[model samples]
Target: MAHMSILLLVISSLLLASTNAHDFIKYGYNGANGADKWGSLSSDFSLCSQGKQQSPININKNTTNYDSNLKQAPRNYVLTKATLINNGINIVLKYDQGAGNLTLDGKIYALTQMIWHSPSEHTIDGQSFPVELQLIHRSSDNHIAVVAILYQYGSPDAFLLQIQDELEQLAKDKCTDEQEARVPVGVVQTRALERRTRKFFRYVGSLTAPPCTEDVAWIILGKVREMTKAQAASLKAPLSAEYQSNARPAQPINGRTVQLYDELHNVKKAPSSKSD
Candidate 1:
């Protein structure tokens, strides 16, 4: 019965990927056909066995711009190394990291690689946000912790633009960049510029990838970033049909509670491929 239910969910996700935007099929999970085999391949994988399924939410809560006056960085974030994957659909740049004294409300956490998801995941009340930056971090005892930032469509961010410009020299795929002299959107388009309003909703969740590991501390940011329509379009500009949309659907939450942090009623707002 569980296998049948999971298969049904897979079919539903396939249908969801059939959005009018584009047709692109995702890789992995059932990449090799057997959905229940990732656990035996590795031991540090429990989300595969215990993960609760959930669909991406529509955040429709506080649209009112509030004073995001929260101050202070974690005082322990260090970017060690960066790994880039330009697969034509979306550029995925990961940073190998270190946390000197990483702490959230005083709890220790270490920096990990970051990933991007279009049309941001966790929603507020019911409205879906546009972009999300998943910063994977770990704690003192070695547990998964993710910081999810939801972005609204607005003006382009300068910090992101800087990173975008830097990636021009490191692109692996020529088809992804139009001019061949500029960086791809994956590096420049998804990022949070707001130093304050770092407050976020906390909960337990799984990785939105194959094996669906559930060992994670999920942090959904109530504050959102801004990017212009033109900037957003540029992200898709370099994307080829292969990398047009590479997002995974949100996993099921079962009957879990979606907790919020420093609730400010703050809210805002990914894709895959066709089975070809």
Candidate 2:
């Protein structure tokens, strides 16, 4: 009986650990599991509160130093098989076998996924936009680099319009809590999403969410793109109410240098601040 009891206790412990591993503790944008309480929620997330190099920072134009050597990373994206997944919190378009590769700092990172945040995350000179698109890439060594584009309400975004049907279908599907709803979006050409700008802001920062891992290279386009109100609404429609306004507030710069790369050498005119 004693041996059986010990075995049962070990099994229970293992089961508890397995459950925790599969179902990660919930973290969100507001309330109990809000950004403020993320670090304390789990040991893995301690960096969320403690990391000095966190992301989605305000890029102050006046303070940014221009680096002429900084050239825009070449985005060699092509039409590829993709899936639109509503991961309960946000809509993620994941590319299977990668859409393309970005050559940054002598390392080639494969474009794996894209995530959208409403009301923007990073701001330019303290001005916010209506939407932000983040193209996430990973290198052969598992390093992360994100290219971000901010958008204001105006002309409909071509990329978003391309996937409008998929977005609507995903939104219509009832995804159980914590379960992802995925829809195959067929071959998608991501080159249209690329902005025609030589100017961008570069910085090293952490992931904006919990488990805020640092050392991520961020390249935010200096030009603000345009998207229609309906296009923005379609993105938010899939997310739950809490995650609809799903952008983390901008983090402090913390003395980290924000570099500006402008092919035209024109830093006097700031990036556009047009809003809806």
Candidate 3:
């Protein structure tokens, strides 16, 4: 009995240490665990430093190749039940039964979640915007694709305005001791958030966050959308202080081809200077 008790104690200690190690592993947008240190944070995140093809690259209009063969993927988004949650890192809206799917390259990738980043991640001619909305989709084979929309401050976004109340409530809940800050946002119409543009930039890249998984299909809208300053603030209010400005710096293109898909087949002139 004594030997058995000692063996159990040893096993328990090892289990606790394993759990504690996992809990200690954390990443953030600033300070010690910032983007710069992400590569060394864990073995899983080594791709963040070593991957040849990463995301959020500045779309240099002059250098991008115009692919007439490329076309806008069909977006079939519908109203669906969603839950907004402050995932301790960023705000995410998870769909219960998936909002819809985007048909691209002969595959259907289901829209599963949406996330936001302030001060935008991807840049156009090296110019950043006030906000960025990312719609995440996954194919049946577990392939990932992201459609990113950049937003400039202007008239309020109707979709965001509809969820303003829930956002504020989430912000309030985050300040408490509640481990899970999630609210049922009822049925959300994703179509209302769609931008009316056929032009987009496409490339193969990695996930923006840790683990930094590569092979993600990125579709960045060529046209920048508009949203009110207040709406942008509401999106950031629920996140912790460190995450308020959560955007990883643009990664190197590393010889990857960026294809611009436009029906008109005209490349927009690159701005000489950065503007809002």
Question: How well is each residue in 54-162 modelled by candidate 1, as lDDT tens digits?
Answer: 2343333343223344223343454344555444444445553442334564567766556566656566665566667777666767666677777788887564565
Query: Residue pairs in steric clash, candidate 3?
Result: none
Candidate 2 lDDT, 108-214, residue by residue in tens: 99999999999899999899999999999989988999999999999989898889999999989877665778999999977676534667899999777767889
On TM-score, the leading prediction is: 2
Position 155, candidate 3: lDDT = 87
Q: Report the lDDT of model 3 for residue 81.
A: 95
The alpha-carbon deviation from the true structure for residue 188 of candidate 2, after best TM-score superposition, in angstroms, is: 0.5
- Which candidate number has the best lDDT? 2
Lowest summed lDDT across 10 adjacent residues in model 1 is found at: 267-276
Residue 241 deviation, candidate 3, in Å? 1.4
The Cα error of candidate 1 at residue 21, in Å, is: 27
Q: lDDT-based ranking, best first?
A: 2, 3, 1
Q: How many angstroms is residue 216 displaced in model 2 relative to the true structure, after the best TM-score fit?
A: 0.1
Model 2 misses residue 175 by how many Å?
Answer: 1.9
TM-score of each candidate? 0.59, 0.87, 0.86
